[model samples]
Target: MTTTNDTRGVASQELFERCTQIRQLLAAGNANFHAIGVQYNLIVDTRLAEKAGFKNAPEFLTQQIKELSRSTLVTYGAVARAFSAEVCSQYGVSLLNQLIVYVEAAGVELDANDPSTMLISVPGADGELEEKFFGECTVVDLRKAIQRLRRPTSSAPLPAEVDARAQQCSAALTGYFPQQTGVRVEVRNRKGKAVMSLKDVPLEQMEQIAALLSTALRSSRAA
Candidate 1:
């Protein structure tokens, strides 16, 4: 039993608010478009539509983009493909995983246990030979689950001397290594686990330290 006057008043108020919001959004969109055009030095001549087979400049641009899609330039191919796929999926992009893959493909030599490093293992010439290499170096610690990733070795069975020597070497070399003066090395055990961490040592020096640790561990075990 709502009164006609009251219902009309509510509808009118709702319509007014919606109109204001729509107007604001339209203004913002126009501003953004103009900014983009200026930045890109685009000539937005509306008259070019007839020659370009479109009713308006915007329509002309849209068709041009579609044409470009069929034969994409190498520089824009990957980005355009990703953008189109995301738009088809309601603007959802698989950014994080894709970036991780890209980062992990950039090669850099590093110890297997290094928390900042990722290793990619590939098959070698022989079926029994596996080639292990370092990929991207990152500051973000993926330590906990990194072992589950493709690694050359495991954790869990490193000699106590390996840990001690790595720390000693880190203390010995204070100002070297890219990105940080205090270099840290994380070594993976045979099981692909990062069982030791050493900081502030040069890559070459760390190798020597590892070799020494291996010998000491072997001798102690034999004794």
Candidate 2:
């Protein structure tokens, strides 16, 4: 009877032969490494799908790869094709995955023509939006700049009555829209007049607010 060792040896030899053939094909320029890498990633992604009852890995990986900076993706793809996964692991390719979040949080748009520059929007001291150019920035530098930009600038306290009115407005809005998560309402005294501001209010909520105001106005007129 044939032993298990013989079968194992045969399988190993067959795998080695297939790898040699593939190497020769790639060397002769008859195979495309880019296409090969994509196919390989797809196969691995499929195998990784729904593993341990989690289906998010494949989709998340695809989206993360898609969202990488164009320059980073180009560099990574070249390195990946030349040395495959080993070079990617060595070069910390995961850093590219965080590029999107950094750019978005910085509230800046990347210049596709020049990755070293960004278009940033900042609010002026007078409450006007200002567009500015941030040049000569790498990904890490841009992230640091964004962190500084996001820091709170105002330390002044609100007037007591304005603060109280703001809190009352917030509480009333919350009570009115218990299911809404992002709604904000603020009421402040500005030059002896009440100024109200609403932010992140949903469209449906805005419509409801309008209807309620119209009803209140009609009832006041009837009185």
lDDT of 2 by residue, 151-197 (tens): 64435556665555555555556567655476766655555455678
TM of each candidate vs. truth: 0.20, 0.28
Q: What is the lDDT of residue 9 in candidate 2?
A: 61
Per residue, candidate 1 scores C-alpha lDDT tens digits across 108-166 of: 43222231233444333353423232333221222212433445544465566665554
**Runs with alpha carbons beyond 4 Å of true place in candidate 1:** 1-79, 83-88, 95-187, 190-197, 200-223
By summed lDDT, which 10 consecutive residues of candidate 1 come out lowest? 68-77
Candidate 2 global TM-score: 0.28
Off by over 4 Å in 2: 1-48, 51-99, 119-135, 138-140, 153-223
